[model samples]
Target: MRIDASVITPYPTFAYSVLDRYIDGDIIIDKSSALIGTSSGIYAVMGDETNDDFAPMLMHEFKRREMLNQRFTLFSSSERWDRRINELLGAKLQRMPRYSFTFNEHRFMQSQRAGIPDGFRLNRTNKESLEVNREFDAAYIRKYWGSVERFADKGFGFFVTEHDVFAGECVSIFSSEQYAEIDIVTNPLFRGKGVAQCVAEAFILECLERQITPRWDCGLHNTASIRLAQKLHFAAPETYSLYVRK
Candidate 1:
């Protein structure tokens, strides 16, 4: 489900959050001010450009305070349900498009077939593990790869270090809903190695030992991430759609 660009003027913050989950969308525009977030950059209407940003600008006008009570759903499989729910916006639920890749939890420790080059080890992102996350921000993350803080308040990871440079990291985000969100990121120089798959295996084992079900998400166009997930064990592909007031 995608919200048209013109409707974000009044509530840009909410709109920015929406884009992190949207595919083929960027630059939410409006007037009043510019508010950019991690997933996509936000732009506000100004000077002669006012007419160009009408899409997001108008979205704000149509949003109702009652919408605060409305809920947007992310289905396990996207199936154009969001369009069907548009008529019920103020009265019932809001549907959005989202595709989830489900993977089985690894219970037993596999062999060391996956290697992390040499002289590096997996570490957690918690207070005790390491702090590579502080040095890395969202902007740098958007290029070629993206990663989550993984339960930020209580993050855990294996920091692959090369002579102490903090090369890359891995994590498994845990939510109360019992969903397994696998997250991994490597230093740009270490792209083609089996680093991610290695960390993912360990992460899945961690989730299984805790009894959590793993889940995966990627843009419909991000073939690399999608393939990696499938290779690492995302059972199959399931699609969901999203919709918002135009």
Candidate 2:
């Protein structure tokens, strides 16, 4: 039985609940309230034993979508869901381990008054900057935040500039009332100069002001990101796994 509804009704799953904030349109919720699909090519099942019963039917529906060779991750928590989804997809799933770090507000505030690097100024991404800013990569704006207009209107980000040239940026990948996940990228020329942290510091401080916690998650193998989180005082890592089709 297909449940024809857009905008996933409120649930406790961190994955789906936070999704509504990032996405601008409808989130399809199928029967059983377990399978949630997005127009952005992402299909996720709520991570719980109760939702396990819907796995087979959900896979069938996904196949019926005839998405061709388009790739998307199956996000879940149960190993049982993983196995069943693998069987339905007819492929060995690629297991990717990830770690999530909790925010340390007090530590973040330590650099509240910190100064920007020499010759560089810090600024928030606003409609004016987004419209006229040529220093930032246009592709990156689309890939991470969907578009410059969205980021300017609904999202929060900080960019560092040296003489009006982009140095680095830290932006909210997505946010809910409880937490906001951060994504950071630095221009290659300014990578080793601690530019990423400067902008990230600004982002976290703003999150604190708004009473929203900042979240950091990265692949287990991403040592650079892990270290950066540590330097920013985000510790106590928790492990989670996601299923990817090979």
Candidate 3:
């Protein structure tokens, strides 16, 4: 009963083509849908919608995503499979702030504007600038920026940075789904000096302005990413393992 996700198409192919670069391993495709689950990080489906009857398949996927964790499942969801997800979420968020990352919405935005250094600036993509910028991530960033822009009306926005071409462009993603994902890749040439942190703080502020949640997630082994998240008050971590078909 395999499904051909490519033919049944849920999310657009254009988006997946771009994200393919970030995909780490082998992919299993079914006519029903494509499971872009992971064993190391966030397991997500790209705008995929189908197979609402995954109850029988939930546990397999949980294991597929490495959520079984050799002891207790670390990540999983079953459509009416169990009362566990609700229980887990309730316990995890209990007594914690409604929005673990929501602090001063108004003040956060103000702080971003105030903290801008004399030479540093942030703004939306200018097609003209992207057309001529022949740098490393410049082209990719332009593409990525455009991808995020399509969803801008859905509460996603990106701000490009050119402080150091070697360090790569700073990146961020805001979603109505209670998260402003911060992704930064600082080239080895620009290792330290708080550039990533500065942008992270600013990104958070932007999400706050739009009243969305800010989530900072990284591989457990990436201590540097964990440290940066902590610095920007995304200290709390929700740990989970993922699996990629071989």
C-alpha local distance difference test of each model? 0.45, 0.65, 0.41
lDDT of 3 by residue, 1-246 (tens): 343434433222222322343323224444443444322333333222345443334445545444544322222222321243333233431111111222344444444332443454544433444444334234554343344233333433233345634323344432323344555665465457454665566667666676655665556677787666555555445443222322
- Per-residue lDDT of 134 in model 3: 34
- Model 2: worst 10 consecutive residues (lDDT sum): 4-13
Runs of candidate 3 exceeding 4 Å displacement: 1-149, 155-168
- Cα deviation of 153, candidate 1, in Å: 7.1
- Residue-level lDDT for 210 in candidate 2: 83
Displacement of the residue 152 alpha carbon in candidate 3, Å: 4.3
Worst 10 contiguous positions by lDDT, candidate 3: 93-102
**Could you tell me which 10 consecutive residues in candidate 1 have the lowest summed lDDT?**
40-49
* Candidate number of the best TM-score: 2
